[model samples]
Structure formats: structure tokens, C-alpha cells
Target chain A: MTMRLVRTELVDSREILPGQWLQSFLAPELSSGSRAGQFVHARTGDLSGLVLRRPFSINTADPATGVITIHFRTIGRGTEWFTRLRPGDTVEMLGPLGRPFEVDPRSRHLLLIAGGLGMAGVRSLADEAINHGRQVTLLFGAASARDVYPSSLLPDEVEYVIATDDGSVGHKGFVTELVPDYEGWADQAFACGPAPMLAALARIAEGRRERLGVAKLGRKRGVGKPDVVGSTAARRKAFLQVSMEQNMGCAVGACLGCVIMGTNGVPQRVCREGPVFAAEEVAWESGW
Target chain B: MSPADLSVDLGRGLVLPNPILVASGTFGYGIEYGDVVEVDRLGGICCKGTTLQPRIGNITPRVTETPGGMLNSIGLQNPGVDAVVAKYAGTWAGWKTPVIVNVAGESVEDYVEVVQRLEGVSGVAGIELNISCPNVGRGGLQFAIDAGAAGEVTAAVRRATDLPLLVKLSPNVGDVRPIARAIADAGADALTAINTLSGIALAPSRRKPLLGNIYGGLSGPAIKPVALRIVYEVSQVVDIPVVAIGGVTELADVLDFLAVGAVAVQVGTAIFADPTLPVRLVDELTDECERRGIASYAELVGTALPPKPGAPSSKGVEYRP
Candidate 1:
């Protein structure tokens, strides 16, 4: 669905994890229309010195309550400002901005990988996949055990896996190490994380097509033209899709601040062409 | 209300249906607003800066919030002149409002080349030279800084295209009179002042600069005083119509610009906070004129300027310095 600006009221704000916050807003326009992978550009009170509105991924949207939750860390003044909002205060929001993840209907098994605070970008997709009756396995990576996303917040059906760099929690080393074991079983993979991790994931996904020997579906052994670069159908058929991040402005494709280099030799707008892109479409090693 | 009364003749026979034009960089080729804002209602649009070749722009964190304003160092991130005209000219050709292409470059040749390409384009109505880009680190000479370069580039581009030309003035310069005089002497039809004031913001941790580019252009209500001072200074120096752009948040700010000899005003950074402000200002301006019993907005122009010494004018002293 196309993006629209909506006004929402702060319903609840809580500290779900250390230095991380989860605030719920009662907004119907966003709750009913927002899909997995969509985000909201929220305007903070201008009473303080803050002038620009902040963008956040919709962590969870409850259609019944008309409430949507956003998860974020207090890394700067903008995020810190959000934590002080009262329950009844109103905020102007522009959303569900940007293109969303396109999940193939035929895919039964979905793998979601998130690193550190990147979980917010992929968290909603888990809710969506489970509601669509797809089997989901989530691999979350953090610096330590305390930084991990709480399992109680996730749907009971999702198979959750945790990895910590310090060996203070579930599995030691990076979360990408767990993907190979499930690579053969899963039909599609989606990830949101640090640039280094996303880059690593993109490389692994590029080789999976050859290693799995998975037959290219519905092509009839290559007949017609290739799927248009950066199209939704192209992203759905790809084995890996990533949600990219950048400092944003306008959040509606007006400001070209948030952009990623594309394989088509053009800078694709992350706010328009994607915050979600097929792995191959990105120039991962160009050091943008 | 008569729509005919709203029409304005901006010298050289160029007329506009209204006076509410979107400033460059903020509007993004005039299509970014989509359905949120009615482009047809706007009088004109100054698109983002276009150069001879594509610019990747500065690094990440291009924009940040400051006190009563915002700082940006976008560094003219455009898809080059040819790509820009090819991508949006057709869409603009279909719109009722005119798209004034704002061109910026490193040299005179760059400006001429870009303007030459836009000369016969269907959607392009005019040209606005961005002579005040202050974020670039090296070899980026601010055109509005010196009278000689400003006059040279303005004359060169004036010769390159028949499109109406408007040269933007930088506020960072010590004295704007010489530069404004040179640009007008070089054949510019109008002038826009002032671009953002040079400024920087500290990171929240207070350890470093907030913007990735370290320095950024300060824009918003915070810079209104500085912009007003420059507009007042440049408008008196040049006979060409002045198009004032600064922290125009309300009708009072608009009136203040007009009082200082600005024939028209372009609303910039303020749009991010209030997108409806420009349209509102249009209505407010009409009401203000009506309330004052003035037949046209022209009566409000230059009311604050001192009387010219040689020319017997009743207005306020031309600053001799």
C-alpha cells in the first residue's frame, strides 16, 4: 500500500531492553494499513530544540486496538526525547512509508536474521509470517545476553535462536554462522543489521543459489525477459532480502539523503525504491 | 477574488500566476510532495541544484536539528543535468506551475553547460544560480563571495540561455553590495538572498560534530535576522527584483522581506516543519494588502530603504559603507 501521514496518540512507553525503548501509539490509519517491513516517520514536539522528525520501524501493529509499537535505542537526543513523551500526548506521523518486504506466497519456511538493534526492522515480519501460517525461525545476535530481545514478546510458534559475541548467552560467534544449518530448509531469508553483517549476508545469499541446486521456479527453463531490477516481484523471488538503513529526511522520497548504490548504476532511493531490497540489487562492496 | 489580480510581471515580460514559489533543495524537483501538497496551486518551483555531472554528495548524517532551525550539508547531491532533465522534465511539462531549475557548479563552464542543456526544455521556465553553496571543503569557490566571479559567471550563463535568470546571494560574505551590483550588471533578472548561514552542531555526547560533514548550512527561523539583514542590504544595491528567501515562517516575516525591497519570496527549510505555510502566506499576504488598503503588493516594497542621495526618493539613507 502507498504511504500516508497519520496522527497517533502515545498509548504506552516502556523499557523493553537496556537502553532500548518500545512505545505504542494508537493510530488507526497506520494500524490497519501498515504491513510487515513498513516504517513511520514520527514528528516530535518542537517545544525543545529538535526540529526534524524521527523515522522508526513499526515493531508491532495491533489492528484491533489500532495501536502500533516502535522499538529504538536512545543513541541521540531525538530517541532520548521520545522516551519522555506522556501517554496521552499526540504526535504527527508520516507512514507507512517506503516499500515493504514482499513475501512469496509459496514459501513455507522463512528465516529472519537480526543483529543488535536491527531487530526492530525484522521484528514485524515475524508477526506477519506467523499470521500467514509460514514456519519462522529467528536468529538474533547481540553483544551480550542482556542485549537480546525478549523471547516472551515473540509469538509462541516462532522458533527463536539467540547468539552472543561474548559467549555469555545462547550461541557464541556471529548469527550468520547459524544460517547454513537452515539454509537448505528455508525458502526465503530476510535480514536487518549492521552494514558489515548485511554485507556478509549478501555474499552468503549469492552463493546459495549455486550450492542448493534449487531449481529456478516458474521460468520454464528461462524463456522471457528477466525480472525488472528492483521490482517487487524480483525481490520476492530472491533468496535473500535486506532492510537497509541510512540517516533520513522528509521520509517520503523528497530528500535524497537516504540512498544506496544499485547494481543498475544509479543511486536508488532507500525511502522510495526500498528500505527493503533484493540482495543482488545492492552494490554491497562499493563502500557507499 | 480575481485571479488576474494575482498575476505578477517580473520584468523582461515574464509573468507568474502567483507568488508562492518553493525554494530549491527543499522541494526536490517538485514531485516529492505528491498528493500531500497541490503543485498546481504553487506559482513556481526551484528544483535541487543541478551540476554538469552527478554528485554523490557528502557522507552520512547529512542533516541535523539545531536551535529553532536545522543544519544540512547535502553537498548538491544531484543526478547531473542531463539525467535530471530527462527524469523530471516530462512530468514538469505536464504541470501548470513552472519549474525553475536551480543550477550549481564548480566553474563557469559547468554552469554554462548545465544551463545550455536546459535551454529548450519544455518544463524549464527559468534558471536560478545557486551561488552560495558553503559546505564543500576544497576548490568550492562560493560564487556570491566575490564581485568579479559573480559577475563573470552570471554574464556567461546569461549569454548561454534565454531563460529568465535569478542569482542567489550568500550571507557569509562580508559585504553583499558589490556582489549584488556585479550580478545585476552581468544581466541577472532577479536575486535571491540569503542562503544558509555557516554553522555546526555538537554531537549529543559532546565529543564531536553531529553532522558527518562537520560543517553545515544553518536554516530555519533562527537565521531570519541574518537573512533579513542581507536581503535589506542586497535589494538596495541591485535594481533587479530581489527574491527574498530566509526563515519565512509567518506573514510578518514575509512582510519584513517585502518591506526591504523583495518583490517576491521563496519559502525554504520552514516547509519541513509546516508544509502548508507557503500557501497560507499567499492568502495572508492578500489579506494584509487588503487590510492596508493597498491596490498591489508593490506599494510595500522598499519602504524601509533610505532615500537615494542622488535620486530624490522619500524612502529611508543608502548605507555608504
Candidate 2:
């Protein structure tokens, strides 16, 4: 798809949590064509010190209203600058970029997992899955009840589950602890979070097939043919797919600034090859 | 007064329609930005660094933002010389803007071999030697640190191809004049001063270094002063033109570089914040020249340099340094 640099006007901005923000922009070009897991590289207003545009997952996109939203926490100058933007202020955005999450067509049950601000990464997928008449279970984890995503913002159709580190919330443990309850019920799983958490879930996903004793379908047709790591076909067939994060420069795969170690001993560009990848395709313990 | 001529020529058949170029490593191969930028309007595009073999580059956390700049340790990741010539040469040949390939190598022979492969490539207008890539393990900063090595590499590549050669200088040196002179005497058409200063940052946890390579080249406004000083020092010793690079985000930065004897300026880290900046600077520079009623931008060059020997040194070099 042709990526355009559009001048998007901020239509709404609000403080969703203590330090978290949710901003909406009137970007018809981005909202119309962007999928669930794609993101936009937004240019900040102050050019003096901040030299790189911030990459934000498209948290939500409404083509009917021509509005796209981004959810973020004010952790640094770039995020702080975004919070200061008022409605009517125009910001330049380069997007509908990076590969989007590929959901298997026949998968009727989809399990989504998100940690903290990573909710922004998988939030849109919930909406997209429901629109396709698939059942979605979103397992969200946060630091405490105060930092948990407000259920009022999600669609009424989703089965929202929460796990907080502190016992003040739903499940008093890591979100990966809540996966086993839904592994058997889910046909496919997608996640985005801290590396350790994703790695933990990946380990669990490895043993899931044997634990559930699920028959490997279509194995004979693909015998002797190794799946190409990071390929769309590989990600589609894997039980777990994850969205990865890195310190980025161009966000269009030019600078080679955001790369992660791949299983094949080659470095993968997060902005080009993925922000999405099959759990098996990444070399988790490579310490890259 | 027709939009003040901004074109510049860095000898040996290389002429930029304007003086603003997108720096190497930052602009990719000129196709990554898609329609976001008007590629044809740019003065030039220095595509990502190329080598004899495809390099995977460094590990994760290759970039980080500092107070007024950023540090990057990309290690010159590229698809190799042959792949580059095959993939982008045809596309670049169709554009009005010149595409200068930035070549990096692990050794002097590596640099010459890469240049030889690019000698007759259709889209290549010139060659920019990345002799000061601070991210690599070897051969990058080695060539730029010593005068003999810098000149030797420049001369080797000069013999390999007839392409206009621009050798990039490193800011890590204590004195840059000798290296600058050696490279110019070696037949380099121009010089690009300065490459990023070596620096490092701590991870958020403070457990270890932030960048995977442990060290990164710092660029942006933080290095502008250092760049201006090097350009001033190098331009005085070398007869060839100087193309200044380091944290150029606006017209004032461009003018500052030119005043210090830089014939052209390159926008590097700033492109990440605004991909359209290089093209915008070209327009703004023309306006600045017109506002000053200058016939061409060349009149603005070396305007702030110390007067010649017979004349008094207004504000002397020591004061600026």
C-alpha cells in the first residue's frame, strides 16, 4: 500500500489514567486502510531536541467517523509533547505502516494478551475480530487496579479478563498465569508486552499442543518443508504470535535501528519484517 | 532576484542542483519514505552505507535520544554493493536528484572493491567514504583517526574509480587539519565534516549500556558546534569543498555551516523527526539568499571565516574553539 504523510488534526485528547493519555485524530486516509496491528509514526511539534517521530500502535480506527486513536503513557519528552497537543492542532503522520497481525480465517476463537500500555497494540484486534463475528477473550495485565484499562472503553462484546501484580485487581499474578485457563478454548493467541512476559507465554505455547493432545492437521502436506521464519504463512499457522518493540529511528526500516534477533541467525527489522512474529521465529534467549 | 541560485559544485563532475542533501544512514535508499517526501526536489540523497558483503549490523537498542541529540550504533547494515546496484540504481537513474552511495568497509581493500563495483553504475553520481563509522568493530574510525591511513584509503579508492570522492571526517580527533589536508592531497574531490562524536548512554535500569554496541555516534544539534569548528578548521587547510553534516534541522544551521566555509550542508538525524525537512531547507535557503540579495549561495560561504594573513583575525580561532 502507498504510505502518505497526512496532516492530521487532533479532534480529541483526554487523560485516560494518571499518566496515560488517549488522543484521537481526524485521519481518514489512515483510518480507512489501516488494520488492527499496524502503527503510525507521529512527528512531534518541538523539533529543537526531539529528532525522531514516536511510533504508536493504531489503538482504534473508525472509518465511518474518519478518526484514529493512539493510547500512550507520558514517559518521555515525545509522549509528553503528544499530551500537550490541543484539538485543531495538526500533526504529520506516516502510516498504516509495518506488518499487521495475521489472523487465521478459520480460527473461530481468538485469545489476545496485553501488558500495560501494550494494550494499545492488541486492542484494535479485539474490535476487528468481533467485527468478523469471532469470539475474543482479552487477558489484560497491569501494575494495579489504578493502572488497569477502564472497561468502559472496550466493546461490550469482548470477554475482558484482568491480572494485576498487586492483589488489588482480578488475578493476583502475571497475565501469563491466566493463559492456561483459555489455551484449550482458544484456536489462536496473540500477545504484546514486556519481553519476559512474551517469552514466558512462548514457552507455554510450545507445550500446549502436547498438553491438549490436539491433532496436527495439514502436517503431511507440509512435511520436509521448513517454515520460513518471519513469513506470513509461518505466523498464521503458529499457535502464538507476538508484537515486539525496540528503540526505533526511521520506523520505515531505513535506519536499521529497530532490529531483533531472529531464529535463523539473521536480524529482523521490526518495522519491516514485523512488530508481529510467530513465537517460534524469534530467538528469545539470544540476549539481543 | 529569481529565487537566489542555490546550486553548488564539488569538483570532478559532481554538481548538486541545491546544497541540501539527506545524510547517509538516515535517508535509507530514498525509497523508504514513499510519497511522504518529494524525492526529486531534494538536492541529493546519500543512501545507506554499502559494503562488499551484506552486513546484519548491530543488535537491539541501536538508537537512543539524548538531551538535544541522539546516539546511534547502526554498524552500517546494508544489502551489499551488488544488491544495491541491482536494486536501486535503475530507480535512482530516473530521478533528477543525484544519489551518492555512501561506502563503508572493514579495510582499505574492502573500500576499493566496493567502489570498483559502483564505478559505472547508472544511478551513482558520486561516492561518500564513511571512514568514520564509530559503530563498527574495526576499519571505520581507524581510517579517519590517522592522516596516513585516511589519505591511503582515499587514494586507493580514487585509483579504483573516477567517481567524485568525498571523505567523511571524524570528530573524535584532537586535531583535524592534517587529516583533512592529507585526504585533499590524495585527490578527494570534497570533504564531509564531521561524523558523529563517540558517546554512550545507560539503559533505563542502569544495569548496563543502552546501545547494543556499547558505543554510538552522537548526532543532532548537540554536535552542531563541533561540526562548525571542524568545517572551519578543515576548510582552512584543504582547497577542496566541505559538505557539513551534524544536527542540521533548520536554515540557520545550514547558513552557519556555509559561513564557516562549507559549500553544502547535509541533514542527518533531523530526517527522523521530519522527512520533508531536507526539501523544505532547500526552499528556505533560496529564500534566505534572495532576502540577502545575494546572486548565489556561494557569496554566503566563508563569510564568517577569519580574515587572511595580511588582515586582522576578527574574533580569532582561539575564541571560537
Candidate 3:
């Protein structure tokens, strides 16, 4: 569906962690229309001289409850403004934007990975995968147990694993280390995290296809057939897809603010082409 | 009540159906508003600044908010004039409203070259010279501050094209009258004053500047007074019509610009806060004219221009002192 501005009321706000917040808005229009990997450009309170609306990934959307939640850290004035909004306060949002993660129908097992606040980027996919009768294994990394997302918020069907940087939780190392154990089990992997972690995951995903001589989905149809590299079909056939983040303007592709260097040498707009892209489409080390 | 009576001849027989034109940069290439704003309703659309070549623009943090306003150091990030004409001309040609191409360049040759390329473009209706983008250090200030340079470029572009040329004036210059007069003398169809005022904001940490470019151009409601001052001064000196820009956020601002001798106004920074403003202003202006029993909105223009010495407002007055 095309994107549009919507007004939603604050249903609830809670401190999911010490400095992290999970706020739910009562937006039936957004909850029903939005899909996994889409985001909302939320209007913040016009206090503290903030002008730009903050972009947040939809953490969870419950069409039955007509509610959508966003998870964020109180990094600056814009996010702080959202936390201060009282229940029943109406906030405007331009929404259901950017392309969603294209899951192949043939894939039955989906492996998800997230780092800290990146959970919001991949959270909805777990719900979507479970509803589609797919097995989901979520590998999450945080600074410590206190920073780990509560398992209670997730669907009971998901097998959740955690990695804390300080050894205060389940796995005591980087979350990428856990992917090898599930590489043979997972049909496809999707990740969202800091640039370094996503880069690491991309490297692993690239090697997995080669090391296993993995006959990628749809490959049986033809070996040398030319498929469009960046299309949803190509992304679904790949072993890994990643969600990216950048500072944005217009959020509607007018201003080219949120751009990431693509493998094609031209900068792709994160708001238009994607906040999500296949691992190979991005120039992982362009530093942009 | 006839719509034909509202048509205005903006020199060289380039008549506008009405007088409400969306300013350059703020409206992008006129397609940015999408379905939210009806582009055909506006009198015209002045597109974003187009250079001879594509510009990557300034570093990150290009825009920020200031007190009752905002600052932008966009650095004229465009995909060159040719790319723009190639990409948007077909779409623009399909529209009823005229699309005025806002041109900016680094030198006299650059200005002439860009305008020459725009000549005879089917979609393009006119040229709006953005000679006052303050974010760039070099070419931006050179043409705006010096009258001779401004006129030199204007005359060069005039020689290059028969298109309606509207030269935008910078508020940074001291006394815009001579500059306005020089531009008018060079045969510009109209004048647009003023572009943004140069300003800087320190970072919150106070260790560095807030904007990535270290400095930015001040716009929005805060610069309305400065814009009014420059427009008021330039209107008295120039014979050609003056279109005003800078800090026009509401209907009052449009009226204020008209009262201060601006034939039309361009809404800029305010489009960020309210994208529907320009369209709303067009409706409000017509309603305002109807309420005042004026046949056209042009009748409201220059109503506060300190009555030229022997005009009606000064005819009966005497030196009582």
C-alpha cells in the first residue's frame, strides 16, 4: 500500500529497559495496513525546538487490538519527546513506508538476528513468521542482561537466544557466533544491527552458500538464468537480507538524505528503495 | 467573476492564470508534494536549484531548526540542469501550471551556459536565478554581494534566452536598491528578494557548530522582517515586478509581502511544517480579495509602499513641521 500521514493516540508507554522505551499507539489504520520491515515517521512534540519527525521501525502490530508498538532508546530530544507523550495524546505519523522483508514461501524455518535497539527493525518478522506456520529462531545481542529484550513480549512459538557483551546473559560473545549452529537448520536468515554486526552476518551468509554448495531456492528452475539482483524474488532466494538505518529527510524520496552506498556505485535512498536490502546490494565498507 | 480577468501579464506576454507561485527549492521539482498538494492549482512552480552538474552537496546534518525558524546548508544538491530537464520535463509538460526552472551556477559562463541549455525546453516556462545560496563559500557570495557581477550574469543569461528571467536577491548585501536597479537595468523580467540570511548555530556541546557545514542559511518566520525590509527597499527602486521569498509561513506573510510591494510571495521553510500551506494561501488570497471587493489580488500589491511622493496618500499632505 502507498504511504500516508495518520493520526494515532498513545495507548501505552513503558520502560522496557533502563533507558529504552516501548510505546504503543492505537492506530488501526497503521496496524492493519503495515507489514513487517515497514516503518512510521512519527511526529514528536514540538518542544525543545525539534523540527524533524523521528522515523521508527514498527516493533509489533496487532490488528485485532488495533495497536502498533515502537521500541527506541532515549538518545536525544526527538525520542525523549515521544516518551513524554501521555496516554490518549494524538500524534501524527506518515507511515507503512519502505519495502518489507520478502520471505520466500518455500522457506519454512526463518532465523532472525538483532543487536540492541535493532530489535525493533526485526521484531515484527517473528510474529509474521509464526503466523505463517514457520519456525522462528531469534538470536539477540545486548550489552548485558538488563539490556536484553524481555522474552515474555515475544510469541511463545519463537525460540529466543541472547548474547551479552559482558557475559551477563546467555551467550557471552557476539551474536554472530550463534548463527553457525543454526546455519544448517535455518532455511533463510535476516539480520538488523550495528554496521559491523550486519557486515559480519553478510560475510557469513556469503560463505555459507559457497561452502555448502547450497542450491539456493528457485535455482533448480535454472542455473544460468538472469534474475534481477535487487528484486524481492532475488532477495528471497538469497541466504540473508539486512535492514539499514540512516538520518533521513522528507521520508518520501524527495530529499536524498537517507542514502546508503549501493554495489552499483550510486547511493540508494533508504526511504524509497529500502530500509531493507539484500546483503550483496550494499557496499559494506563504503562508510556512508 | 470571469477567470480571464484574473490573468496577469508577467512581462514578455508570459501571463499567469493567477499570482500564487510556489517558490523554488521548497517545492522540489513540483512532484514531491504527490497527491497531497494539487500542482495544477498554483499559478506556477519554481523548481529546486539546478546547476550545470550534479552536486553531492554539503556534509551530513544539512538542516536544523532555530528559534521560530530553521537553517539549511543544502549546498544546492541537484542532478544538473540536463538531468532535471530529461527526468522532469515530460511530467511538467503534462501539467497546466508553468514550471519555472531555478538556476544557480559558479561563474558568469556557468550561468549563461545553464540558461542556454534551458532555452526552448517544452516544460520549462521561465528562469528563477538562485544567486544567493549562502552555504557555499565561493561562487554563491560573488554574484550576490556585487552589483556589477549580478548585472553581468543577469545580462549574460538574458542574452542567452528569451525565457522570463526572475533574479532572486540576497538579504546579506548592504542596501539592495542599487543591486535591484542594476538587475532591472539588465532587462530581468522580475526580481525576487530576498534569499536566506546567513547564520550559524553552535552545537549543543558548545565545542563545535551544530550544522555539519559549520554555517547555514537562516529561513522561516524569523527572517520575515529582513525580507520585508529588502523587498520594501528594492520595490521603490526597480520598475520590474518583485516577487518576495524568505520566512513566508502564513496568509499574513503573503499580505505583508504584497503590502510591501511584492507582486507575489513564495512559501519556503514553512512547507516542512505544513506542506499544504501554499495551496491554502492561494485559496485564502482569493477569498481575501473577494472580501475586500477587489477584482484581482494584484490590487493589494504595493498598498503600503509609502506612497511615491505625489500619489493619492501624499497629495493632500503638507509639511506641517
Best by lDDT: 2
Docking class of 3: acceptable
Residue A205, candidate 2: how far off, in angstroms? Answer: 2.3
User: How displaced is residue A211 in candidate 1, in Å?
Assistant: 3.0
Best candidate per DockQ, number? Answer: 2
Which structure among the candidates has the greatest TM-score?
A: 2
Interface RMSD of each candidate, angstroms, one decimal: 2.1, 1.1, 3.0
The two-chain DockQ for each candidate, comma-separated, is 0.48, 0.74, 0.34
- Candidate 3 residue lDDT tens string, B39-65: 888878889899998876666466676
Give the lDDT ranking, best first: 2, 1, 3
> Of models 2 and 3, which has the larger TM-score?
2
**Model 3 agreement with the true structure over A184-288: per-residue lDDT tens digits:** 899989889998999999999989977777787778867866445457776777778898887665666665556677787666667777888888888888765
**Taking the tens digit of each residue's C-alpha lDDT, what string does model 1 give over B1-321?**
332245555666556666668899888988886776778877688999999899978765777777778888887888899999999999999988888899998788888999999999999989999877531432666777988888988999999988999899888888989999999999999888888889998887899997878888888888888888888888777788888888877888888988888888888877766566677778888887787777777788789888777966545446544
Tens digits of per-residue lDDT, candidate 2, B67-136, equal 7899999888888999999999999999999999999887888999999999988999999998874324
